[model samples]
Target: MHSAIAPIPIDLIPSWLDVLAVWATVGAALVAAVTGVLIWLQILQTKRSVDATEQTLTLAREEQEQNRELIANARKSRIDAELPKILVWIHTQTRKAHDLGVRSASGAPRPLTELPAGKIWSLPDDGASELFISLTVAVSNDGPRRARVTLATSNNSFLLSENEQVISVGEETLIEVRRKYTIEDWAAMSSEVGTRSIQDVLTLTYVHQGTEGAIERWVVRQSGSPLVPVPGRQNCWQLGPFAARRGPLTSLTAEVEMPHRDYYSSMSDLTVLV
Candidate 1:
């Protein structure tokens, strides 16, 4: 037979032991509350640390962008300091006329000098006068650096002396262009004189240094009125004066003429020949 368990009487239990058990339970609850508070504080600290890191990163990015801009501005300043400024103009003193195999009444080719004053040679078939005017165009460099210049024109009417030349600072070089005009062309231009003008655009490509394939280009537009009948002279006409200016190639059609300042103030020794 199994023996039955005997139960102790409640009054026989110790009073101090019950009190100690209650106090132990209260201590465990207090420890749990403190642990939860510590965990919450740790979470708050971690969030603050993350926010600080993000702010640091953002500031660093802004600083980097500022530095990049500063470097770019410095580089642009350096390039501008070394760039060359070129000026172009017509050398009015070098203008001369030439004959183009047109015979006069004597059945011989007439020279320009023998032609009657104030009269140009006319084409035999159309009675249209032919004006062969040769003039020198000056390309002057007023900047501090030297430049290698190449001149080109799409117009078939112009004949350039040479395509390329190296120009030094404070020096000038000449490019001769032969201009031919027929009487019909001149008459049309004469009608518009003082009201409008004709212009021809020439491309000027240049390079400051000898870097391969590094080139800068500009457009030179030369404008003038056509030949007008010389006053008080029968059958006589005079070639009108022309002016040249440099401008950006992109604005070729809308280019405004820069002021006509004397570019030869420091370049007195350079002689221009027709």
Candidate 2:
């Protein structure tokens, strides 16, 4: 009865399998931690890439707009410079045709570029209708002489409007001219005046002389009808009356009277005639 049980065999204990289980658990935890870190790094990189791309696009658009504006301004300058030269040439040709007694059905549109710098023009809406031209003249004279300018316009296509006290010859000396016209009805006015319409008038007082001299005012408009000389208020600028028509082709000649230059202009002084 006192017989002792045989001691369990140490070699039969499960040591290797338990050790393998512990090693596997530690390896799996290490792998999971590494995977989480890699995922966070990837998300941060993706956000930075997106932000950089947006910034690049914004800069490109701004550059494009600036280029477009520069191109527009250059084109406008070319147009302004060439317009006056062409107007003057057209006027000369029109006069030649008239003296030779050549009749035209629809008179040619005078080249706007040939217009003198001292003159200003009001053109109609170029896209929809024919062009309309107007002129302003400034003359400085001492004794008394005559000068002539020819104006060619499409019959019934041109208008004479007023620019008030705009031409300045010198200090305390200015020329003011007003356009005389009757609006048949203000209610009948168009809301939009195009290049074909007399939409606006520009007034400028160009300095033609200094403070001292005898300067006489002259009329600046074209008329087919003979000019009737009338007494005027002292030193007041005079303009011929205009008869407007709706349709017809006609050319006008202006006979200007200017006195001989008694006041010599010095090179140091600035003279802006155009």
How close is each model in CA RMSD to the real structure? 14.1, 18.9
lDDT of 2 at 144: 21
Over the stretch 1-274, how does candidate 2's per-residue lDDT look in tens digits? 8999998799877698888998999999988989888988888888888788877777777787777667655544443332211111011212111111112356643333322322211122111222222333333322122222222223232323223332222212222222222111111122223333232222222222333222223323333311112244221111123222222223233333332222222324532112
- C-alpha lDDT of all candidate models, in order: 0.55, 0.32
Please give the lDDT score at residue 249 for candidate 1.
21
Runs with alpha carbons beyond 4 Å of true place in candidate 2: 1-16, 83-274
Residues 47-132, model 1: lDDT tens digits = 99999999999999999988877775564455456666777665432234544534478886444433334544233343465655
As for candidate 1, its clashing pairs are 118-236
Best by TM-score: 1
Clashes of each: 1, 32
lDDT of 1 at 116: 38
Which regions of candidate 1 deviate over 4 angstroms? 1-73, 93-95, 101-116, 120-129, 142-144, 193-196, 208-218, 230-274
